[model samples]
Target: MTLPLSDSALIGTCLAATALGLIVMTSGGGGAAPTPDTAAQTETAASETAAAPEPSLPFGAVPAAPDAVDPEFGAQVRAYLLQNPEVIFEAVAEFERRTAQSQGDMDAALVQANADALFNDPRSWVGGNPDGDVTLVEFLDYKCGFCKRALPEVKALMEQDPNIRVIIKELPILGPESELAARFAISVLELAGPDAYDSVHVELMEYEGAITPDYLEDVASDLDLALADIVDLMESDAVSTVIEDNRALAQRLQISGTPTFVMGEQMIRGFVPVDNMLQAAAIARQ
Candidate 1:
């Protein structure tokens, strides 16, 4: 049996066979020299060649027998790719798609691994259904615009779906004032209660500028909560420890941005439309 030849080997074989054919043609002693009629026939052949159909191979490739596939096939593939460079873009797109799928899978696994800290941390403020079938844990910073945007969506979700629980984890990475704001929110939630905490949370989240002691006092007074008492609670170890624990939990879940939402086995980073959030909650129920 004949061994299968590589592209390069097949090309070499074709070239050798061509050279042998040429040698035999040139050295044939029985052949007569071309007459005027033969020369006329040669001219006719050259004229006919101009009208021949284009080869199946791309332009610029040397014509070869069908069996010539060693180095010649490699060359053909290279030539075809050079002519259509967009193939590279298609390959890159496929790679990115696969990478995104893999990352999503990994994030899901990580979320499952850290479910206890993510969904049931006593420090996190649990809103919506206290015993809801699905829990959506949000990592938030008061100063994050996206987080603020998501607040209404969170509220709407809770309103529309009474069985879906929302867990708030304060991740104050914006600045010192953000930390203070988170500390105060956590403090109010821990010291006063969820109702009071919800009031302070909405006011703080809606406030425009810097969150100072005087500003917080005004907000506290509006809710009939003493600012001094809230400040004292904010400064205490319990509130600080809870925020620190949340930070640690965020790190474990590979969360690096605010307004991240985790539910079921999926971790959604960045702000998404309310429809998508609702869809995620629905998926969790299934």
Candidate 2:
């Protein structure tokens, strides 16, 4: 049996016991093991680790540094890009291919919508086979250098392929001289015939000076056409309507320049080689 000490002495004994207990527990010699609450906390942490989402980084790869991306990665990418510069060209080619396809589709749709005005307008000069299976439509300006160059190629095509019908629409956008030439040609076709118009067309295309009324009278004289008669016919509302209708058709078909060709659903926007023209005509036949 132990006797009770004074209050101060009792307090000192309690403090000593507490310190000894701490030392024993630290050394694993005391019976004061982990409490139930601590054990539960440890188990809970382990469970959370197993249930958490997996990281997005690939296996065996370390996480990127927080301060910056790896410099070597960017350098390697740049070096690889420089080594394969043709990739940019290939991308441009693909873009152009898609753009061409889209433009072709739109042109085809417009052609179909305005087929009557484009293909069968009686006002336009029609050459080659009148009842041909395939028809080639040409939008031309009298003063265009390309149109002048196209004269021989067109003549060759008609001579070679008699079954290909060629319809010419005079789009006089160059200047007054061009309109004068077109009006003269239209008057020739109206007064004389297609043969006279075709003959005058060749002559006008070959002419190498500013086309004035005097020059036109000379062309009429060469073609055996009455100059006064054609001059009177040129001023008629009938001739003007033909040119105005062609202008409207050009607007609808989006004809921005001269020497544009249309065969079936295909539209050749600029000067393509004679071989390409023949190829387009053949495709139209099919």
- The whole-model lDDT of each prediction reads 0.79, 0.80
Candidate 2's error at 4, in angstroms? Answer: 99
TM-score, per-candidate, Cα-based: 0.70, 0.72
Clashes of each: 5, 0
Per-candidate Cα RMSD to the true structure, in Å, reads 16.8, 27.6
Where model 2 places Cα greater than 4 Å from the true spot, the runs are 1-79
Q: What are the clashing pairs of model 2?
A: none
lDDT of 2 by residue, 1-286 (tens): 1357854455445544544443433433223334688657857986998899867887789977645222344344445545765554565567667877999899889989999988888888888999988889999988998889988888888888888899999989999999999899999999899999989999889878889999888877877888999999888899889889988888988888988999988899877777888998887777
Residue pair clashes in candidate 1: 6-70, 7-70, 7-71, 8-70, 8-71
Model 2 residue 278 distance off true place after TM-score fit, in angstroms: 0.9
Q: Mind giving the per-residue lDDT tens digits that candidate 1 earns over 160-270?
A: 888888888899999998998999899888778999989888887777799887888888888888677788888888888898898998998889889899978778899
